[model samples]
Target: MLRTMPLTKNLTLEQINHLIDTGHAFISPFGLNRTAYIVINHKPFMVVVTDVSINAIQLSGSWYNWDELEKMGGVFESEFEALKAVAGGA
Candidate 1:
């Protein structure tokens, strides 16, 4: 249970640029367009970039951070996949 999940990390410059370069479009659970970023937190998470704010999901507690950039996202999932579509793009 991801009770009161924390917004402990913010996207770094490197991570942000990488996301802008490789962020893949995905349909949110709400069926809107969003971009997905693989965030390297204590564990790996799928961060969904929306027009208003970013949302994240920890899929099965797996950890996978990209490159020299050390960044983090959030937790849990009942929403749709944000990490799925971008697995190969980055």
Candidate 2:
């Protein structure tokens, strides 16, 4: 059976990694050289893993590149942290 991730709170870094490593995260092509792994939560936030290198959390609207997002304090140490930072607009 497929394991369902809980959406009550932000996922941990380990959990995000597991989702990517186990091919459970949704995969989407970003560009010719990049791929995105997306994890959606019940809340208004979503965590996106880019080519296994960077993690970006999108609360809503369009996506932005790492450089542009970093300027807005959107960059984080991990997917979990990114999600936590954006949770409830914190």
Q: List the pairs of residues colliding in candidate 1.
A: none
TM value for model 1: 0.18
Q: After superposition, how far is residue 9 of candidate 2 from its true place, in Å?
A: 5.3
Per-model C-alpha lDDT, please? 0.36, 0.46
Which candidate wins on lDDT?
2
Choose the strongest candidate by TM-score: 2
Q: What is the TM-score of each candidate against the true structure?
A: 0.18, 0.23
Residue range 1-90, candidate 2, lDDT tens digits: 867443435888898889779977764323222222232332223333333223433322345665556455554444566556556344
For candidate 2, the per-residue lDDT at 65 reads 60
Worst ten in a row by lDDT for model 2: 29-38
